[model samples]
Target chain A: MSDRTDPPGRRSTGKLIVSYTIVGVPLLYGLVATAIKASQLFT
Target chain B: MGVTQLLDRERTVAPPGYNRWLIPPAALAIHLSIGQVYAFSVFKNPLVERFGSSETAVAVVFSLAIAVLGLSAAFLGPWMERNGPRKAMVLSAVCFSGGFLVSALGVAAGQLWVVYLGYGLLGGIGLGIGYISPVSTLIKWFPDRPGLSTGLAIMGFGGGAFIASAVSDRLLRTLAPEPTAAIAPAFVVLGLAYLLLMTYGAWLVKVPPPGYAPGGYDPAEDETGVEARDITADQAIRTHQFWLVWVVLFTNVTAGIGILEQASPMIQDFFDQVDASAAAGYVGLLSIANMLGRFVWSSSSDYVGRRPVYAMYLGVGAVAVLTVILIGASSLAVFVLGTGLLISFYGGGFATVPAYLKDLFGSHQVGAIHGRLLTAWSAAGVAGPLIINILTESQRRGGAEGAAAYRPSLFVVVAMLAIGFVANLFVRPLAEGASDEDIGRRHRAEPAGSPG
Candidate 1:
């Protein structure tokens, strides 16, 4: 099921983005760097 | 009352329109952060130089952390279950990130024991709690697809090393101009960062209300043939199946870790034609494979079943190790492929074990049982490196050449895998009424709805 607004146990889009940014920023940073290192080693 | 009330699992039932997809990302937020524990070695050299301690002394920190991880996961299993995943995750977030903050101070002051207390002791408990908290909740939310759901989060743990190794290196280089003095600030920053990430996970995590399965999934059709009885943590340890799975995990980990802990050096030692850079590349490739196998093999187990999947891990793993031993490093491709496949199986063993637990024991306190099983990992962590290092050293002393140096050690791993294979064969269903006795005991012992 999906909800638009004011749902129980479901986070709002703004809240979701805040949570994602907190976790995603570091993970993305690391993944991008890993890609760079992989390229350097393979190429 | 507000944050606590929001965090209370009883108060957090999903809305009629709650989307289950949001859960996996919440899990990943914690797993990926703690998985950075595997990359703790990135700081090994810097730590050694900074503290004027031997590499062995620095290594003790990692070993101690792993030991604590197993011990706490096992001992704290019941408490974690009673409190719920949300509370468990919050505690993990605090201890793990706080360990870094404390260890940072230890580094700045050069008090090595305090560093051990911070990262090794406190951080290890964080690893244990962070690991088991999401497991039961994922099974509850995705009852029809436990393997696939758990695999997604576990893969995040495996991938954490890639993120941590890369990010920590960049962070250290930029932040620490006085390289030795850099560890403190780096620890502070990283700790704060992980706290934020894991707190988001804690904030987001919610246990599905009892009996809430996904729509269109028949609880009747979902029968795994394993009886749906509630086996408490205490009863699980008393069962033959638990010990057998423990041996299976220990051997699988020992064999795979024997290769992983020595991947870089073993590659160079085996192939004189391979340079240092090439060996590093090989090690990197194994890390990727290790991460991939966590997702692929574990997800596949849902279709093939946990037993057959594990049989493949143990049986095929033995063959791969044997291939390296017999063939030596004559063909670079074979060496790489063989070792890489073994690494995949190693990761697969980790990803598949929880689903196996769910099969043998019912979902009731499965998280607690899972925590107990991870003790095998701590044992294997020590055993793997010790076995590899000792055998290789003795071989070198006996005047073994290049690839010949690793042959004895690799064969030893094959023998270990063979034992694991035999143990997997002995894994049958738990005896009848074992769950009943435990459940009855729990009912008499505690108030309704309290965790086992």
Candidate 2:
């Protein structure tokens, strides 16, 4: 029964961008490393 | 915003029409970052040479960290429940990543004790908190599919090594190739990176409001035949079901750990023709199997029911281990397939347990209860390696050569699994009665806010 509109902070687009960026950096690293390793496997 | 304000649960409650899918990535962000603990093996050779210590001494660092992880999670579960996920996550981020930073400084100074305190003690605590931080919140957001929802997040923990293995190796090589000098700077970089990543998970994570359920699902009609009783972590420990699940997790993890710890060596020892490189590749394949099983098997557990899924995990896992012992040396396919299935169940076991807890005890403090149960993981982590390492060494001394050296040890694991299977069989559902939350609700009579 506690349903209401989304809270104030969650509304900000900037917050989403920042969170994505933080997670994105490591994910990008992981992807690049995978790509390099995969290329080696093929070559 | 204030620190507490930023982490406040009321603020994190999902809005009407909010997509539940977004929550898993938030969990993944934390789990994957913390999951890098599995990839700590990449640093082994370097640490041995740097501290001028034996490999066993260096391994103590990893073992200590895992031990502390379980300990802190058990103790900190309630505190986290009180503060909510975002706060716990931020705190975990600081401790986990900060442990690396502190350990880096220790390495730079050539102080092994400092490394233990930072990486082992501090970072381990961070890992425990980061792990449980998102779980309760995720369950709240996706009550309709507890197994699958938790699986998606927990699978990230399994997959963490896949990402970390390649990346950590590259980071180590680029920043400081010399094993002795490389560890400190590499730790610094990884620590900072994880700090950022875990913080993102902290920021992104949210809990659902009281009585929240996804659209189109009625909790009352959705019958898993489980009582809607809320049990606190303290109350849960009093139940036989909790200990049964504990033993189940302990035995399953022990079996899996024995295989994992011995992965590369076991394959090589079993067959003379397979070289180290091939064994390494095989280990990688097992890693893939392990990661996939987390998602596939655990998600499937939703439909299959928690107890049967575990029965399958322990029962089939025993068979697979037995198969490896029986004809693994003679046939490579049998060895890989058996070990692969075992590995999948290993990952599956970890992923499925949270949902299993939700089924037995209501979601009301499921996170705290899950945290308490992880002590089984710590015990198994130690016990598994000890059984594998000691028995194999004893066999080697006894002149049981090659694959024969491993048989005695593997059989011991099978015995352990048989006990677990029995434990799984006896895991009776909790009696339909007043749970702790109900008692508290009646006593204090605060309209019970649904346990997140």
Candidate 3:
């Protein structure tokens, strides 16, 4: 049912980037922090 | 329009040219926020100290949260299917954040029961609703790649705890020199922060327009041919396939949580050189594996098909445990790697089930089906720990030490995984006739525009 002829315009693209960033940063932060703690295993 | 009108499913339908990719992030926001429940253990000692209460009393708060999460999800699944994710997300935000604020007050007032009412009862409802909110919508949006879509969202659930664990420690350290004093204000801050993030999720989430599908995907040509029928939640429960998958999940979770519940102490029991700090690192490694596996294995299911992928999760996972039983004491690396592999499978099992349900029963009510299936998790949450603890304790009482103390429990886990592998084999595609009729009956019963 989506209108494929009408592509998501510039503002929509910007919103996508911001939306991903909002969730992405925190997840990345968690991964990095957990990785740091996990590094203790090798030590 | 009023707020009620704004939150309705009709208002939340995807507009022309809206990128389907936006939905995963919105899904992630809700998952990440409610996934904080995984880190509730961080509060146990502090609360115990604050209330001058026993450790078991503090622990009951978590048990209640998980129990209520399962019960509420099962009971509310129909409501969620009817109302749509945006409304559910808003309600989830209110309950989850409000749980924290109310618990904060309870902490200040020294009422353990009030904390139980707030965090346990209210927040558990938040966990239940927020969990299923985005699932069926994601399936509708990504009909061709249900595994990948659901994985992207559920992976957030596994990862949320790591962020929350770190955040809680930092806040507790900074807010008050005495950690006990910090519990109240910390809850307030966390509640407010999660409310903001979850509100963003509520605002952004949208249901796919009716009959929406991704641009290039075709269901008739789908290689697996698993997305066969639109089965209602009630109809789904009556099918043998449903119970088989339920058994599959229950056994898989029971096996994995055996290691998880005993991770820290078990590592030391196995390896003499390992200390508490190193044990903590091992637990962290498992957490990383758990989080990563949710994404990796579930995404792989999109390619390989759900049944085969779950076969790998249980079958290969059993071998991973066997590796620990055979050579684990000989090498620290072997023990960590083997258990870590099994835990990854465990995480994958959790992430993959929603998509699996979608494949078997269709997306119409997959979220509700998924909600009902989580009772397996709730059951395993109890059964897994009890099995491991009782066996390990009895072993210690019988004069066993080192890995010997845990060997019996480890064997039990291997058997559980083997059972799950068998259950996974028994799962068949839903039978054709009854489901089609049920769909017709259910549709007529439903009002127009209902998700189901």
Candidate 4:
């Protein structure tokens, strides 16, 4: 759904990256932590 | 005037050429913060110790939060839709964070009632408001891919608990000499952190400009297996289709909780070799499955269609539960995989429903309709766990061992799924005559002046 070809004011790639980062970093951390904990199911 | 004017729907409309992709993350921020309610169990033992109360008494706090979440969501859904996501989200942030601060004071003062009023009532309102705040807006923005867009945001609700569980556990450990002593401070820290994060969501979110559709998108080509009809929340509830959908959600959730409510103990009881830590891992794995499934299954619904996808969740999900009973009891792999699949469907059921409602009732009042429908969840939350607990305790009292103790409840879960499947079959499109004009006339008659 990228509007890359849209006029100058339409593109917000920088803001897009920042927005994803705000929620993504914490989500990644939680996923890794949960994955580590879940590894105990095998061991 | 300043803040009020800024938060108005007209003020927050997307500027020309604004990318819609940014909206999901904003929705995600609010969902993730409020999803912390799922992790309230982490504080159970600490609170029990602090208040010198019974486990049931401490447990009441979480129950109250969830019950309130459903009730408030059902009642305030129209208000959120009227006010727009930005203002609703800001209100959610304040009540949610304010809940923590109030609860912290309650903890310090050794008053359990204060904590209930803070976390349960106030925070529950936040959860309810935040949960539905972005849904209708997301549906509007991504009309071509309503399922995928709503799924992206709702997925945060499932994943939020994992983040909260780990973060809250760590905070409890390091914040004070004893975890119980740290409860108040942890609430403060979490409250502040959530406020900052949720505010970012409120700031970033914008409603799509009227008549805006993505380039290359056309409504005539829509293919979700149902013709669209704009039905207000009031009128939507009066349809048989609405209650059928409600039953679909209620039964799906009730069945899933049959496994989740006692994941740790159930696994250990199924296998002699499994310990608390291994069971803990199993629970974590289920959380991952639940989180991922919300995104995967709901996005797939955009293609597979909402009705058929729900059929799979209910129909195939029933088979999974039965498989768990027949062979899963003897095999850990079967048990884990079966229950994990069930839980994924459970989460998927939640994430997919908004799009499902949009398909059935149209986007105009989907959020409010969705809000009213969540009362089913509140009802199921109480019924599911209560039924499982009672059945299992009875089995244990009867001297049943290992998997035998849970066998009866598993059968009940399968039955619940079967019921949901039947309900799914009954969910046909809104009858051909419920035209937009007819619904609009009814809405205009109502005195509330609530926007759809």
Candidate 5:
């Protein structure tokens, strides 16, 4: 929930970015890695 | 107060409901029983002997089970929060015990897929649900000592393996000469026992009473300042710090799982030039080290704060893995000690992380974020073992001598820990404006003299 009209101090774009990066990157990495590993498993 | 006022009040403060001490024992019951999953390797050796299965094939079963643990938790978090932990615990008990029953039948009938579906899929769902059920509740109950409280619950998870190893070993010996046949009866008995124990734990679990706060709490001294705002589960997922933690956990768990999955073989390979009995003993020692680390290092995090504690884990873990590679099995004592420290840090990483999450995001929807974060564990469960297996297999094929086959794998773990250390460095207190009203309520409910 972004405080769109709020002043910069009240808003936390940095926190939003950090959260996305923290969860998103690893999730992507895990998915890619799993696909690779699963392919190896079937092959 | 009217319903809206009551709801608003609860949004800020804890609703009166349950005992705090009951949480840890409940956690212990579930964790200690589920810890059997880690001991699946014991079954691995036996299965290969009985069914003539490949090591990779057997390992895939364990991997699948662990993956399901994470996936199930992601979905189960909301339900657990909605219904309270009692229902969740009961469900876990049934699923976990029933899984074992199914697995027992699978072993008796010599159906490998049955074992996978039973233990891997069903039992994993139990693990996922049981794992997260207590975390957020405990944090709410002990907002003053989130790290210590969460650590106590998770420590049981680490220690559970120790109990499983001993019990499973005895059961295997008594039930049948072969693992497949012996494992069936053992699974059946263990499943029944865990069902009863976990049900009792679920019965004991209760939420804290409304407006109650931990005694003698103080806010100023807490590592994360009271100025930090709470964030909801959805809002938490939107933050960069959340993803940072995901990476941190992913790397930390993957590195540890790498060593854990291959511990026995790694030890044996390390001392290939030495006595076989000694190698086996080294594996046992590593288990002891891993179990002890959960309590020792995580308890210490209560005093040191989470960042510094994780720094120790990453730094020490890196050195330990490197030492294993460079030492080349020369000194048994050095090898044992290094591996012990590495295992301790591994356990500690899991135990300390819940508190770290509380510090970063406040206690609001911590359960959900923690659930989401567990996806990293699910990923690592597969990644670590696969990497180790592939590397070791290739090395063996290439005619690499003994422990040398393991060197590259150790280096990979080292690199993972190094990355984890960098991520730990980036962790800081959450900003003031970001925390939600729930944290304020939790803070306000505390006694006047208590720290926020």
Candidate 6:
């Protein structure tokens, strides 16, 4: 079994930010779009 | 022998691993079921007749399923990695099967929310988990052939819809004389079959033996000169390349789905002068093209390299979309050919992405990255349908003439593919510092010669 203790790279911080950005931006877009559509449903 | 020796012996004899052959079957089970999403149009006319609901309302179920697929995969990636694929596959099968069961009950009771909850939310979970379960494992087993392995597994996903479309159509025709009643039992039967198939697949999976490697493989001999890395899922999320890839995937998927959502209508519109039967035949041909592209074009990536292959997908795909616009309703042949090529590239994009991930990030955290990136599919699922629906609805309201309304939507797809092509151009080899350290660490830490 490989040792679990060794820290890999701190660079993944950049990746994490980018990932969240990529995931979050479109997600937020979808939510806003859905909200807009839902509002239209009632109107 | 001492305990350590005994443990080592056990590791050598039966690695905490799954049978490689089992992965494909498990993948097929999940894919075949979730592929039903593509057949939602079959139910559209029926639902309108029975429930007195609008097209938009019925479409929401599909949108919800797709949206949930990404959400579940994003949230579930780490858990899947920790628990192993077996647990993930089992959970997926159960949720997927249960979704159908719930939807059946909902249909019987005439409740829309139940269908949404059952098929959309629960089935979506199955879609996400089943989608990702076999990918990383297949790559691990065939490290020397990441492109081929991932392509084989994903081909099943792309083709699943083709199978589901046929099966569901037949079931609808033969099983129940009425639309609403016919679909509920079909759901029940399909759910039970998928449960059994997925369960068998889950049981068949095992991690490869410690120190096991495929025969005749040497990392140093490869031209990509790409080395394996041991980055954790957490570490993988920190790189710019990962997010760049995410964008590429997002654009590609969205572009394809945009066309897919509007395929039948678009074909009929373009071929308005032609017979309806001919137009329907063209639609079926597009589906076949999509299914074949998943295997043929993606498998070709194994030799041509992922970057060049994706560049073709975007560049050619853009032209294909534009060709549809240029041709308008003038020539049914041009429209059919263009639409077929677009669908092929769309399926090819899905099949090619996992290999591209392996190329950039290495196989260590590929499953996680793949899982994370699948959020793009979810996003595209929503975007593609919404863009087409909103545009088409507005065009109809404005009394846009035949084929002209579709022009704006096709342009949107073309723009998206253009963006994806640019992203593909931006792709380069991962930084050496990152690549080397990852390889060195993983190499040393690996238990002997095990398949990654």
Give the 10-residue window scoring lowest on summed lDDT in candidate 1 chain B.
B443-452
Q: Whole-model lDDT for model 3 versus the true structure?
A: 0.88
Winner on DockQ (1 vs 3): 3
Q: Give the TM-score of candidate 6.
A: 0.80
What C-alpha lDDT does candidate 4 achieve relative to the native structure?
0.89
Error of 6 at B235 (Å): 2.7
* Candidate 2 overall lDDT versus native: 0.82
CA lDDT, candidate 3, residue A28 = 88
Q: Is the docking of candidate 6 incorrect, acceptable, medium or high quality?
A: incorrect
Better of 2 and 6 by TM-score: 2
lDDT of 6 at B136: 70
lDDT of each: 0.82, 0.82, 0.88, 0.89, 0.71, 0.69
TM-score of chain A of each: 0.63, 0.66, 0.79, 0.74, 0.52, 0.60
Measured against the true structure, the TM-scores of the candidates, in listed sequence, are 0.91, 0.90, 0.95, 0.95, 0.79, 0.80
**Two-way DockQ contest, 4 vs 5, winner:** 4
Q: Is candidate 1 or candidate 4 better by DockQ?
A: 4
Query: Candidate 1 residues B101-181, lDDT tens each?
Result: 999989988999999999999999999999998998887777667888888788889788888898778777989686677
How much is B131 displaced in model 5, in angstroms?
1.1
TM-score of chain B of 1: 0.94
**RMSD (CA, angstroms), candidate 6:** 12.8
lDDT string, candidate 5, B281-399, tens digits:
55556655665677677777778888899888998889988988888488756777787788778887887777788888776667777888889887887788888899888988999
Weakest 10 consecutive residues, lDDT, candidate 4 chain A? A1-10
Candidate 4's C-alpha runs over 4 A off are A1-11, B224-229, B436-452
Best-first order by TM-score: 3, 4, 1, 2, 6, 5
Better of 1 and 4 by TM-score: 4
Candidate 3: tens digits of C-alpha lDDT, residues B231-289: 77887776667778999999999998889999999998898888888888899999999
Clashing pairs in 4: none
